[model samples]
Target: MAQARENAVSEAPYYQGLAKSMMFTIALVSLAPLLGYALLSGYQYTTAYKEKVEAHLRELVLKHDQSVDSYLREKVAEVQVLGEVVGGDRLKAEAEITSLHNALVRSHGSDFVDLGIVNAAGVQVAYAGPYPLQGADYSNAEWFQAVKRRRVFVSDVIFGLRGVPHFIIALLVDVGGEQWVLKATLDFMAINDLVEDIRIGETGLAFITNRAAQFQTTPRRDMTGEVKLLHNILARGGEDSILGRGRAAITVVDDPVTGREVLFVTSPLKDGEWFMVYQQDTADAFAALYRIRNVGVAVLLLGTVCILAMAFLLSRRMARKVEVADQEKDMMNDQVVEAGKLASVGELAAGIAHEINNPVAIMVEEAGWVQDLLEEGLQKDDNEREVQRALTQIRSQGARCREITHKLLSFARKIDPTVERMCVNDLIREMAQFCEQRAKYANVRIETSLEDGVPQVEASQSEMQQVLLNLINNAIDAMDPGGGELDIMSRAEGGDVFISISDTGCGIPKANLQRIFDPFFTTKPVGKGTGLGLSIIYGIINKMGGDISVKSVVNKGTAFTIRLPASKEGMRCAAGNGAAGEQPPADGGRSEETGG
Candidate 1:
C-alpha cells in the first residue's frame, strides 16, 4: 500500500484565475433554480417532521392491517370446518358458537367487541363477547349481504347494534346450498393503541385518515373515545386519489367543523383505499422560527446570497495562495528526499545492529541456562566448569553488545515497525521497565493500570513502545524536580483496544498541542530532539489500523489515547518490542497472519 500514490491526482485550474472566475459566475447563475428547488422540497418534507414522528407508525398500521386480514380469513376458513362437523344441523351451530366464541375471546383478548354468526337466513342466531348483539339482524348489513352471496367483505367503521365503534368483517359459509354469514366486529380502540406510540408536542395532534379524508385512528385525547373525522370533506363518492399514486396533495385547512389549522402529510396506503395522514398543529411547526418576526424571510435570503458570494471570494483568494503553497510543497519534497537519504543510511545502521545482536541474545540465554546447570552440580569435569564460566562472561558481554545495538537502532527507521495482534498492556509494561533506569536518572515515576482480558491487537509493538517511552521521557524531561508520574493503561473495547499514556508533568501549551504530531514538530530545545518521535508514532499508529488522539489542559497534563484493532499474532513481537510496525525486511523477518 503506497500511501503517496493515494494522494496523487491531476491538478485543476486555480480559482482566482480569469477562467475560474468566469466558471464560478456561470455556475452560480446556472444553479439558482436547483438551489431553490432543493430548499422548497426540503421545506415541504421538513414540515411533516413532528407529524410523522417516526417510520414505525406507518409500519405498525400495515402490520395491523395484515394481522386483521389474516384473523378474518381464519374465521372464514373455520366456517368450512364447522359446516363439515355439524352437517346441516342449525341446532348445533349455536352450541358451536358458544364454544368457539369463548376460545376467540381467550386467544385474542378483550379488544374484540363482537363475535357473532348468522344462519342461512342471515339472522344473528348466536353472539358472544362484550356488547352482545344477540337476536340482531346483521344479515342485511352491507358486509353480511356481501358474504351471503359468497364474498368476503370488510365494512367501513360503523356503530354496531351494541353501539360500539367497530368494523364488520364478514364472509359466506355454504354447505350443500344451505348458507350462513360469519362476521367478526373489531373495536376501533385497537387502532388508538397503535397511534399512541407517536409523540405530539404541545398543541399538536396525531391522527390517521382515509384517502377520502375520513378519520380511521387518532390519539385518545378526549374521554368520549368516539370515532371522529374531518367530516366536511369526507364523501363516499367525491373526488378520490387515483390508485398506485403516492404523495397526494397536502394543504393547511380548517376542518370546517373543528376550525383548527393543521399541516397534513399523507401517504397512500392499503392500495389507495386509504391514506395514512399524520397531521400536526400548523402553529407549532413554525414556532421555532418565530424569533425572526416579519424581517426574517428577507434576512434569510440576503444571508444565503452573501454566504455564497463569500465562498466564491474565498475560492478566488485561495488561487493566489496556491502559488505560495506550490513553492512550499516543493521545499517539503526536498526535505522528504533528504529524509529518505538519511533513512538509507539508517538501514545500514540497522542491518549492522540486528546482525550483531541476534546471536548475542541467543548466547546470553544459553549461557544463563548453562550457568544455572553448573550451579546445580550438573557438571563434574573442572575443564567443563571453567569453559562454562568463560562462556558466561562472553554471554554477558554479548548481551551488553546487544543492548548497545538496540540503543543505536532506536532512532532508525527499521526500529519502529508496523503493527500486528499484540498484548498492548504487556508492551507498555515492558516499556515502563525498560525506561526504569532512564526514569530514575530523570527522577520520574512510571505507573501502569493494565486491564485484565484486554484483547490483543494488530499494532506496531516497537512504534507503540517508542511512543510511550518518548512521551514518558518527554514528561520526565519536562519536570523541574522529582514529583511527576507517567501512567500507562490499556483496555479492550468492542473490536479495538485503547492504550492511554498520561503524564503528571507540566502540560503542553495550547497553541502547540495541535501541531505536536506534525513531522519534525517539537517544543523541545536544540540537542533535545529531532522532533520526528511523535510524528513517526502518529504515522505508525494510523498505518496500523488505529488512531491516536491527544487531550491536554495547560497546567494539568497530556493524555494520548491509541486505539488499535485486536488480534494475536503480534503477541511475541509486542512483548519483545520487536519490529512490528514496519514491513518485514524482504529476506530477514518472519511473516504470519494473526487471529483477531
Candidate 2:
C-alpha cells in the first residue's frame, strides 16, 4: 500500500510545484514581516523594561534605609544625654541612679533590658536585671573601653553581660579626678522587630546581615531560632570578580537552601561592611509578562494569516511588470553605447602617439640615473642604495608605460563599458602634463588657468581621460615651430562648467568649422590626422550633457568652448576630503549631451 502511494505521488509534477510555491509564499508574506517587527521592537524594549524594574526596586530599598538611619540616630542622642548627667555632682549620687532606674521601668522601658553603674575602679557597682550582674568585670568590653576615651560611647552591635543578647551604650563621669560609668542596654529583639515590620511584595523578601555575613534578622521562619549565615558569593570567588571581600552585586541563580530561582539585589549597610538584600522569586517576577506575551502572540499569528493571502497576489503582479520594463531599458542602453564608439579616430591617433613616446622617455631617464651614479665614484654602500632606488624607479616608470599602451590600444580598436567619475580640473591637469612637453617639440607655448573647486562629473575615468588628452594634442599640432600660444582654461559659469581650449594656430575656415565634429572630418595632411578627434570629443561631451562650439578669425586664434552641466554634487563622498556639502557615490553614471 505504501509503495503504491509513493508511485502515485511521483507521477504528479504540477502538484509538487504548486505545493512548493504555496509554502514559499506563506513563508515570505507571513513569516518575514512578523519576525522583523517583533525583533526590532524587542531590542528597543529590553533597555526600557530593565530600567523600569530597577527603579521600582530601588524605591523600596531606599525607604528602609531612611528608617534605619532615623532609628539609630535617636538612640545615639539618648546615650549622649546620659554622659552629661553622670558628670554632674548632684546626679552621681546613689539616690539619683535608683530614681532613674525606677522611672524607666514604670514607663514600659523593659525592652531596655539592662542598666548598670560602675565605680571609679571600673567595676560594675550597681545592676538592674533579673540576675544581679553587680561587681561584674565590664572594663574589657568595647563600650567600657571606648567611654574611657571620650566620656560617652555608643557601641556597635555586641553580646551583652550574662550572655543575653543586648547592645550597650555607655557614658563616663570624672568626679575629683576619678572616673565612673553609666550604661544602658537595648535587647536585640527590638531591632529584630524593625526588620519584621518591613512590608515587601508577595514574592520579595528583605533581610539584614552583619559585617561578618551573619544575619542579624531574617524573614525565614525555619531559621528564626538560629542566626542565619549567608555567603558572600563574590568574596568566595576571589579571582573572577573585581568586587573584593564583602561588596555585593545582583545575583540571579537557584537558592541553595530552597532550590528555587531567586533574583537578588543588595544595598550597602553598616558602613558598607554589611549588605541589605531584597530577593524576588523568579517564577513570580515574570508571571505577568509571560501571560501578556502568550496572548499577544496568538493574536499576532491570526492576523498574519489574513495578510499573507492578500500579499501573494500583489507581489506576483508587481514583479511581472518590473521584469518587462527592466529588459526594455537594458536594450536601449546597449544601442547608445555602440553609437559613442564609432564617432572618432582623432582620439585613436593621439593615443597611439603618446603610447610610442612613453617607453622612449622611460629608457632615457633610467640611463641618465645610471650614468649619474657611476660618475659619482660609486662607494660600495652608497652605490648599493642608489642601485636599489634606481630599480624601484625603473619598475614604476615601466608600469606607467604599460598603462599608456593599454589606453592607446583601447582607443585604437577596443570598445569597453567604462564607468567612473572624472573631475573637470584634474582631467585638464593630467592631459596638460602628458602633452605639454610635446608642445615644447613644436615650440608652442601652452598656458593653463584652471578654476578651483571644479566639480567631478560622472563618466568613464579612462574614456574621458582619452577625450581630454586628444583635445590637448590636437591644439599643440595647430601651433607653429617659432612660437604660437595655446591657452586652456577650465572654470564654471553658474550651473555650467566650461573648458576653453584656444590656440593661436591658423584659424579654422568658416566651412571647415561646421564639419569639425562630423565623423572622420579632419584638415591635417593625409596619415597625420585621423579626422576623429573633434568628432569623438563632440560625442563624449554630448553624452556627458555638454556642448562644444568654435569661434575663429582668419589669421588669428581658434577657441573651442566646451560647456558641461555641473556634477550632481561638488566632490565625491568616497574621497578622503568629503565634508557636509560633498557629493555621494553614483551607483550608475548618468548620461550627458553632445553638440556640433
Candidate 1 matches the true fold with a TM-score of: 0.35
Model 2 segments more than 4 A misplaced: 1-11, 40-47, 86-95, 102-111, 119-122, 129-131, 140-159, 172-180, 223-229, 233-253, 294-596
Q: Assess candidate 2 and give its TM-score to the true structure.
A: 0.43
Best by TM-score: 2
Each candidate: RMSD to true structure?
31.6, 28.2
lDDT per residue for candidate 1 within 35-104, as digits (tens), equals: 6865685566555653454343344444544454455456446544544454444522566666766766
Q: What is the TM-score of each candidate against the true structure?
A: 0.35, 0.43
Worst 10 residues of 1 by lDDT: 587-596
Candidate 1 segments exceeding 4 Å error: 1-92, 130-133, 208-240, 243-249, 254-260, 267-275, 286-596
